[model samples]
Target: MYKVKVFVTLRESVIDPQGTVAKDSLHKLNYGEVSDVRIGKYIELTLEKTDRNIDEIVKEMCEKLLVNLNVEDYRFEIEEVVAQ
Candidate 1:
């Protein structure tokens, strides 16, 4: 079996309004040292072994559905797992 961990985040050039709001809120709550905040998505997927290239499969999934190519960037890690 294989386990995939996907991370999705806004591109550096893209503004993150949600992250900004969170940072502002933190500053208001006495976190003056907080310089920045970034919000992102983490996804986990479990799949059985397949003949297809795992990297290609993951890239396709991220491009087709998980990430916005225009404003977001993504990365993934694949790990082999032993089914219980």
Candidate 2:
């Protein structure tokens, strides 16, 4: 088995409205030093051993479903599961 950790975030050129809203709210709550905030998604997936390369599998998943490539960027880390 393997564990996959995926992170998805808006592209640098894209505007993050949710992040902006959160930042504004923080300032209202006395967090004035918090100038900026960016929001992203973290995903965890477990997969059974497969013949395909883990890297390829993860990339495909991210590109096809986990991210909107036009506006978001994604990264993933994969590790083999060790049974106790």
The C-alpha lDDT values of all candidates are 0.94, 0.94
Any runs in candidate 2 off by more than 4 Å, and if so which?
A: none
- Please provide, for model 1 over 14-79, each residue's C-alpha lDDT reduced to its tens digit, 9 standing for 90 to 100: 899999999999999999999999899999988789999999999999999989899999999999
Our model 2 lands, by Cα RMSD against the true structure, at 0.8
| TM-score on alpha carbons, each prediction | 0.95, 0.95
lDDT of 2 at 30: 98
Candidate 2 per-residue lDDT over residues 2-84, each given as its tens digit: 99999999999999999999999999999999988999999999999989999998999899988999999989888999989
Extract clashing residue pairs from model 2: none
Clashes of each: 0, 0
Q: Which runs in model 1 stand beyond 4 Å of their true positions? A: none
Name the top lDDT candidate. 2
